[model samples]
Target: MSQKSQNQRPDEQPEEPKADDVADSSGTRAAEPAPAQDEAADEVAPADAATVPTGTDGPVEGPGTADGAPGDRDPAGRDALDRALTDDMNFRTPDEIRSGDATQYPAHEASAAPEDDRPSAEAPPEPDAARDREPETAASLTADRLLDARDRAPVAGWRRWLYRATLGRVNVGDSDAVRLRRLRENSIKTPLTGGTRYVTVLSRKGGVGKTTATTLLGMALAEVREDRVAALDANPDRGTLSDRSPGQTRYTARQLVQNRYLVDSFAKISQYASRQGSRLHVLASDTDPHVAEAFDDADYRAVTDLMGKFYSIVLTDSGTGMVHSVMQGSLEKSDVVVLVSGASVDEARLASETLSWLEAHGRQDLARNAIVVINQSAGLARGVNVDEIEAHFSSRVDSVVRLPYDAHLAEGSEVSLDRLRPATREAVMELASLVVDELRGTR
Candidate 1:
């Protein structure tokens, strides 16, 4: 404040700051203010532009800011008029500055130490850039390499030549069809989690390709999966499951049952099983009528118990006779049931009745979750509408698959995936996928 305003004011406007009052001899505002900041201006001398005393006759030096230096202000005086100084800091705090009475901001340090150099408890410390950083992980470091690298290398056709010619820079991926084939193969290759899973192939009548369907289903699963797979010809009558394989073992399901303890391991079980080129194991029932006729649930429990220890999956080729004792155990132990039907009306009717029998006999759970296979292995559908049969079964079951006729399958010889028609192989693949879906559904 200037002298004229001090004496002339009761309720008067303050005088404008003179240029000399805001600056010092060096033209900076870092200099101290008047010794008695509230003293009348006339008592202070203005001759050499030096210090002035307040209550004494002589002048004395002023106290310093908290950090031992006076703060600089805008030369235009906006900051000088509005700013108030406090104990801790006079300038250079990050934000949230506190203002109070510390106007004696001399350019020199006071002999005494500051009350607290640590900082006020309410004001946060200025953050350190290095202190708040997160550590790097392995995934973060390899992210670019993983994203930019090629997952697959072209092996067949001109795609291989183009990749080699460009020094492996230019690349094109596999066709959508090949990708779909890969995905389909992967779907069936899903791991079988629990102990051995059982799948039963059933039909109310024989000759609807029920036996052929079992052979194909076993082959499809065994072709890709590394786990042990067995198809049991537990058909109450002589089952031909072993005949579909290129070679046959002399031992039968009867031998496996009677000598169950001998087949304690898969190596020993191999004596009774006919191992196929597709990696499928066929455990056939006796060709003798009297022995097959006597195969019952007690025999079934013994056979399955031994098979379960060695195989990851067991498929039972059940007979048309629902009254057969083996059929009861097959249905009871089965995780999935494949009900086979031909493309004829009578075959469809008989198969549908078998499904109804399952529902009526307190196995409604199996009926609802059953997979129906419409066997078109006859190579002709001249007079019947196969669509109606499929739709009928579709309403009652979880899924339905159609098997088209293959020339090799019709020959009643050893089955080979390479020999089957593409349509036939595809139908079997879809059926395998559905069976796998059912196995997972059981979990």
Candidate 2:
């Protein structure tokens, strides 16, 4: 041994092994720390054994200490190379390295670990309800048992189109407009009660579409309602009401009066009436002026009383003259009165005056509940304001429906209910709907 070695202290050790020799003894290929959770452990590799000398500042490297991970703190003595490699590593406390504190880890790794932001599960807050409610079981069931199912087939519009395009793979509900239209149809189909309902259509002036309004109201009501509807022509003048319909009988209201007692069944009464379609039966008045003039209040009552037995609804097309006996009979029995008017100013004034006349007479309730229809309107012609007419009547009456001038109706020929324009049909239905609501309300 050298002189310096012989004089060494008891704690002092001989020269440490070379890095390669240290690796061979530790069973590691290089004098590098084994892989650990912390990169700091692998960073400080052992220095060359030959370059190190006996030292009292720190302990010497033992069996596995040279290659031991810095993150570990085992019974084996720690490597001596960390002191010599102090200049190579970032500054950190020895206690920090020994305990493997978060500070000892790499800058990016320590920052990459996320801090938990969730509230602790312990001492959870109380539930909003009295106690915890278990989840509902209905959601797990199939949709077929529900009223409006999520998987129901589409009926109209873009959803229906998409469903068809995809061979029914896609499904959705009908559009809002279609749904509302269906609701309207269903509303019109509402059943009537309290025996038969009597509806009368009249106007103070001639050529105001009174007969046409009567036909439309009867047709619209009969189209959806599952009951027979009858339209009676009580015009004092020779009525062209039958000419507006496709089916007409040579028999007039006079037949119903003469055969009143014999008309015990619908088959007998159907002879005096001409059925326009499946449900609307039109009872025409005499075509001759002198003959129609003779058809009076007794005749009107006879016809209505007989038809009322077979028909659930009877619409009276009253004469322009309010003082006509048939008109009086109509007003007397009418559950709902419809006052038809033209869009012109004179026509509107006449309609309003006719309402006033009703109020002055013993028929104030009839006038108050009457539905006013402004018809044959071609929009803003001859300085006429249809909207103003509608508004005025709306305030005085139960409802006002504007029948826009449709080309098919303008021809004044036989009327086809389905051939009317959409706007005209909608107006007609609106009037019918109002009449139905009034009938049901009066009941």
Once model 1 is optimally superposed onto the true structure by TM-score, how far is the C-alpha of residue 111 displaced, in angstroms? 51
Runs in model 2 deviating more than 4 A are: 1-159, 276-278, 289-293, 377-380
lDDT string for model 2 (381-433, tens) is 66676777888888898688889889888788877788998788878878887
Tens-digit lDDT string for candidate 1 (1-443): 34464476445545556777778688976544444433344335244223221234333223332333222212223233223222224432322222323344432344235757645779887899787895543323432235432556664678767778888887785555555565566667777778999999999888899889999999999997768899998877777888887575788998888788666677889878888476898988888755525777888888998899999999999987688888889988999999999999888999999999998999998999999999988766687988888899989987999998778988887888888887888889889988987897797
* Cα shift from native, residue 308, model 2 (Å): 1.6
TM-score of structure candidate 1: 0.64
TM-score of each: 0.64, 0.64
